[model samples]
Target: MKFSPLLAELINALTCLPGVGNKSAQRMAFHLLERNREGALSLSNVLHNAMEHITHCQRCRTFTEDEVCEICRHPEREASGLLCIVESPQDVLAIEQTLSYKGQYFVLMGHLSPIDGIGPDEIGLDKLESRLQEGRISEVILATNPTVEGEATAHYIAQLCANASVDASRIAHGVPVGGELEYIDGNTLTHAFSGRRKV
Candidate 1:
């Protein structure tokens, strides 16, 4: 139970990862120190580099080390006139895994929760408004999670899209209520994307 100060610090730092508790973090720290220092060093380097260089894409707000993400730079994505809005970058990866969508994305980084003090501007809705006003996208897909907060965020964005005179839709069908896009299966994601309903 009594670890060296540095080891304790390593455990605490590892616990910052999602689902990694104190016990798991201790195991990881111990494993790294005892068996895989090289791998741990590699992980540290990559993490440091990612933190230093990764930034949001100017156009869509997804993580990118460059000025804009590859998806945003793709001409076909703009030509398609379709934009899928997601709560996080993980959801973008999940949807991409399904290979059923070939459209642009707008990552909110978080959903709207008024009690938490996250409003339209907090989640970058002002940037989204600017993007919508550009008029390149003809349809906006509300791909937020099915949680109550996610629903609220989707409805808010739908209203924004409507105000901009762009068609808006919500993904449904195989995706169950309260399910997150990051955890949903590929078939369900594909079905949900394919069966999107007008918002």
Candidate 2:
């Protein structure tokens, strides 16, 4: 009934991933050891490299190996002057997959949670404010999730935009309440982005 120390360590390490519990971690560990050691080694190598090299984009705060992410570096994207603000990188990917948006992004990386000690600065709002004050961004679209924390973050951003005299808009409610952008279909996301209204 006892797992070897190495096996136990593998299982415990795997559980560090979000939504992966002990049983799932155990299964993953066993599968890697029994059937796919090569794939597991490859994954381990890539994880190590990424952890060492990947960092937040200086401009958008998205994960990247360079100072800025590819999206921010793209010439056409910067020229658009429209900024889509989202709580996480996954939301950016979700919107990008729809091909519905052609603009830059400012990723918060998380929603505001006062109880959890996550504040405006914790989510990179000062960086966002500096970006807004630079006057290159013409419009800011709030594509944060429909959760309470997401709404609060969006409202705060809207106020910031107002203070800076920049236009602010919120994506439509096509996305279900309490739903994450990553879970929404491409068509629905397109509709939501297209139907965004000034806030």
Best candidate (score: TM-score): 2
Q: Which regions of candidate 1 fall more than 4 Å away from where they truly are?
A: 174-199
Tens-digit lDDT track of model 1 for 38-131: 9999999999999999999998899999998999899988899999999999999999999999999999999999999999998999999988
- TM-score for predicted model 1 compared with the true structure: 0.82
Q: CA lDDT of 83 in candidate 2?
A: 95
lDDT, residue 52, model 1: 100
| Off by more than 4 A, model 2 | 174-199
Candidate 2 lDDT, 34-113, residue by residue in tens = 99999999999999999999999999999999998899999999999999999889999999999989999999999999
Candidate 1 global Cα RMSD: 6.0
TM-score of each model, in listed order = 0.82, 0.83
Top candidate by lDDT: 2
- TM for candidate 2 is 0.83
Positional deviation of residue 133's Cα in model 1 after best superposition, in angstroms: 1.0
